[model samples]
Target chain A: MAQTNLLSPPSTISPPTALQLSQKAPRIIANPPTSSLPWPLSLLFSAETPEAWVTHENALYACLRTHDDAAARQLLDRLSARFGESNERIITLRGIYEEATAKNNGELEVVFKKYEDILKQDPTNFGVRKRRVAVLKSLGRTSDAITALTMLVESSPTDLEAWAELGEMYAKVGEWARAIWCAEEVLLVMPNSWSAHAHLATLHYLSTQSSPHLAPLNLSLKNFARSIELNDSYLRGYYGLKLVCQKLIPLLSESSSVSKRNQDEDGPPPNLETVKKLEELATSKLAEIVRRYQPGTKEWQGYDGAEVIAARELLNRDANTER
Target chain B: MTLLQTAPKKQTLAQIRQQRSLVRGINLRTNANTLSPSSFQARKAYMVSAYQEGKFLADPEGRGKPRPNPMSDPAAMEGMMGMMKGNMAMMVPQTLIMGWINAFFSGFVIMKLPFPLTPQFKSMLQSGVGTRDLDVRWVSSLSWYFLTLFGLQPVYNFILGSNNAANQVTQQMGQVNPGAGLMGPEQDPDKLFLNEAENLEVLEHRWILDGVEDRLLARTAG
Candidate 1:
């Protein structure tokens, strides 16, 4: 548990894990391995390691998630003291702390105003800019958040995080074409990212519902297959591959003529045999993942519990339809 | 050697920060203008042509060619100055030591080899000793000094780990052309961006999932 605590915090944490980490925060903050002796003695005696700072940072985030505001404040104070107030990262952390502790929309507005002030003084502070966008999003002004994000991406095109966020925002607002473009942009920057390919595949699959074309389904199938090829053990990739193959198998058989007409333009759609084989591959992979993940096995513990459960549900749904 | 080591380490840290800021600035300028749909389409056309031609077109404004001397850049200038200072520090001591050995210990036969040596080594092993008939195995003091000069590398490696900048020979060679690795001063940022764009365009997406069904079946059966 102590070893895990020093690692960087994951983007999303389950409520139970969040609570457990938050419960440990006060102890971590109180007994930081820093020495209190004078400079010379402290340098010689302190048991401080770089991991202690990482643990503190993770503890701070966990405390914020669990609404342990006091513990979060203590960790924030220690961090600011160690890495002065003017440090860019500390400034962003302070903004996050203020955003968390604010009880009302008006207070959030105050925090938002503070972030804007910081940006005005130094427009290059991308960390604070991201925080300001987060504030805009939380205030139920998603369109405004999207505009801000668009400008942010315009300035820093290489920021994969900003591009991914822009994609999510476009998806949230039902701008499927723009969302797909953003996902493609991510792939252009980081072509080997399995998650980016899966995201694009999901977007293609979702868009096909509105415009029932075999082209989008074919595109989705190719992307999902690409994602699975990139990461053999990727649960999300296999799940998406399975879903796309299931949809394409029936479509390919029924609309053989339609597929032939578009073959020259979109490349040939996978034959029924290939589609069936891909479906079987996805099914076997998903089953293996679900079996190994259910017991919280040591090697499989890295997979998120929620994702594994969702994969299990998908497998069960497939079985029921077959029956 | 310690003096030589300190200069490069400090300059490298500063160079990294400088490079990051330079890259971020370039990214902002290039991305800000080309993100619109029409411009993006234009870039795609350019990329496709560049891919077919197997080379990106040079900047029409003549910005990418005939790179200026890297010494003109203030950071490179500073690094070169630091290197010169380190080289001078090293040279002074080496020259003084050579002069002292030549003056005080020139003709002294310092040591002898345990094993026999051929007469061919007499000139090499008895440099400052002005005796043509001297035993080939007897090393002059000047020769001994030269030997220790080159042979102390392993001692330095033992004292400070392998990566220490204590090897005089390698350091002199490195100083001949500073900042010659990736992100070298001579590289034009625009050309690098274009080259990367071309690479991305030419990259073929071969799906690895083609025969995964057979592999899966085989695994299960085995």
Candidate 2:
């Protein structure tokens, strides 16, 4: 796969990529923007492309992550100069800058207070509200974050990001049921997302560890199967599927002779033969993924390095047990 | 005629701005990363309950109040004025050209059609020329103007890229009739949501991964 570009922000930024992007900041910031004169006069000067602004914004983020506050501040000044300080997006960016530069909890709390004041002035500023929630989360106030997120979602039921964040917070606090509900809410909005299926499956698997219930395990198995079905190449889905099937196989074999009374409301448990086959399939798939996704390979460079290593270790452990 | 055509262009730009504000008000772009799915039967069940509870109409500001009509806003009125000014700008040059053509090129054949035409087209193709026996293939200057008026669409598209406002035919057809768009102000969003929910209810959920394992195994074996 081609390396990701810095002009458009990526969902997750690794430390090395952040460093690389921040190193380009001074060069990007050195170029002065085109003079924003009236239309005909503006045309006489060199025109600034929208991509330049996007690059400036992304460079600021990268600088913030790499702790290059000077470069970040310069980029921020340029942005505010162009768009004005009162622009809602610029306000959010400024809030993020303050949060990043805060040295202690007291300074962070002051930043949080600023967000609160911004929200009080314009309650409709969802960006500042989200920042406030983030500040709460960073302050180790999980319950308060959950409360704020719940209010956010109640007002905007279709806000899938808030729902996902709420689910993660619930999972953090071991509120498995609420986390599952939050995941289901996300599923309601986006019906074709394979990653959501894998996420819900992972939540179920985690819940199963705490409660040791056959119901969650079965749901986890079906969801993992559904996720892999949606996206055949999803490594996380395959890994979860293999792990769940391995756990289910032994349990199913042990309970083979037990007389059935009440059927599970979720679904019937997997058959022993099917579970064993799924385990074997998962094992083979994981082995293939690990082999094909070798380091420095051009074709399969998309898989995360850590995930491939984990899959290889799982395969090795399985071989050792079998031997 | 120009006013009638280009009015909708300005309206569309204003509509886009309004929609962007609405999207930003709910933080849609910043929170767009999550994904989800469910079986149709289950989704239908959820939608039904959700609709009954009025979840679709939930206000993001947490106030249970309906929003004002976007078309009636002052911004839309300003857009209407801007569109009028644009139409006026286009009309002056158009009128000047028409007068210039009438003064200099009336009653003259400007060009000929490549293919033969029936005598029925003689009046249309030789509009300004009064000669009754003139071949229908010989196009008058006025007729040529009309042809270019309708036919310069591809030329405009070539020079200005696809979505330029200079195309007259598209401008004529693309008039934004109030309450005619997908999310028009006059349409009740509650009804639209209910209709969509009903449609989703009947949708059959087919799992695409049904025989995926077999397919994967076959590919690997081969």
Candidate 3:
């Protein structure tokens, strides 16, 4: 799996049973045809499992997914009865229920308006604001969604989650510099996070690739090295560092061979020797990571499946280049 | 400040939960408010003095020594509890619940139910219909009273906010633990004031716009 995953990456690993059960709509509602036993009876049996409420909650969405209108309605009724119909979560769930039942996107607009009305009544409602954002995104009004998200982050600056979301939105719009800025904000709050450092590095690498003349190359190399220094096992950090070094070694040579490029305080202008040494360091470290956490092992599974796969691909490409 | 508005969003379920926690973090009393240099220093002065005053009231000795605080006395504690229970929350619902409690025990059945149920139920769940010839489906007035008592919470929340009178579950939990809330009546104002004072004293304001001009100039030059 590791060897072949070089050029073509594998999809997300099937979540372990406990996670899958929590994430998926429960089968009880999703597959009424397959289950011979009645839902209440199934509930009675599973009541002791401590996962019943989660199952029931997921079952509500499951029913919607399967288009089991009756089951979905029943689940919603049960939920609303437990937590009053006017409850914010219940209200949003009702909107979601309607959205699911809507035949077309046009019908979903009415549900969207309902959420807007709810927000207009209580503007501070984070729950409603979140629902409104989702509705806007689903409706393909990316700009409107961005507006709402910007407000959310404004009121809640410490929210790393919102920071990440705003970052992704910028990335989607090809606003690479903006995305990098968002990453830096999160990095400011979470200074010691190796992954956050690596993530910022990735953003810099991407921005430079997209617009080399505009992006800050110095931060790109520094951050990736920082990530690796923070957590040597971080495969993505090493992978990104290698790529940045690969690009820099030639650029440094060209600039130096022509004329001494003006160096800034951020770092001595990436010289050929430093770039080559960093590239070698990245390659060896990546190779060690691949050898230690070969795919299909428990230890390997602990590493981000996608990052490991991508690193494998980079190594393979580098090997081919050498050949 | 400038670059933040243009960024990111997957807006997943976990992200929403995270946002809630982060938002909660800002409201903590220990946190210093975002302020300009002058405003921050002024607020710090105000906070320390206010805290000292509160702390002195709770402990007359202030930080010097301990004293027999009246708040800890049984009579004062009882009075505080009475005030909390007698708070505005009791005005409408308390009268209603009291009236119904009397009505149910008075042996006067106001109404019956439309549905059927088993016989051997608690009086709270059964009808208060005053008669021996009662059907099992007849709901006791006491039960109806409870139904309204617990049921109107969501209605209250809809009319108000979620934290308003509608959620008796939270209210009841709050009742179960009196001193759990910030600055509950039994608290030492002195300690609270001192904490706030210290928090304010150490509060350093970093202006977001500090290096804005330089940053923009560098960007333009580059």
* Number of the candidate with higher DockQ, 1 or 3: 1
Clash pairs of candidate 2? A190-B36, A191-B37
The number of residue pairs in model 1 that clash at the backbone is 0
DockQ for each candidate?
A: 0.10, 0.12, 0.04
Pairs that collide in candidate 1 are none
Q: List, residue by residue over B85-168, the lDDT tens digit for candidate 1.
A: 656755787799999999999899978899998998887788988897878889999999888978877776555434454454
Could you tell me the TM-score of chain A in candidate 3? 0.75
Quick one: best TM-score, which candidate?
2
Candidate 2 error regions (>4 Å): A33-47, A257-259, A292-296, B1-46, B53-180, B193-222
Error of 3 at A308 (Å): 3.9
Give DockQ: model 3: 0.04
Worst 10 residues of 2 chain B by lDDT: B27-36
User: Each model's TM-score?
Assistant: 0.68, 0.75, 0.53
For A102-133, candidate 1 gives per-residue lDDT tens digits of 99999999999999898888777789989999
- What are the per-residue Cα lDDT tens digits for candidate 2 across A185-268? 676567568898889989989998854666677778877877776777888988998888877777777777661543554446
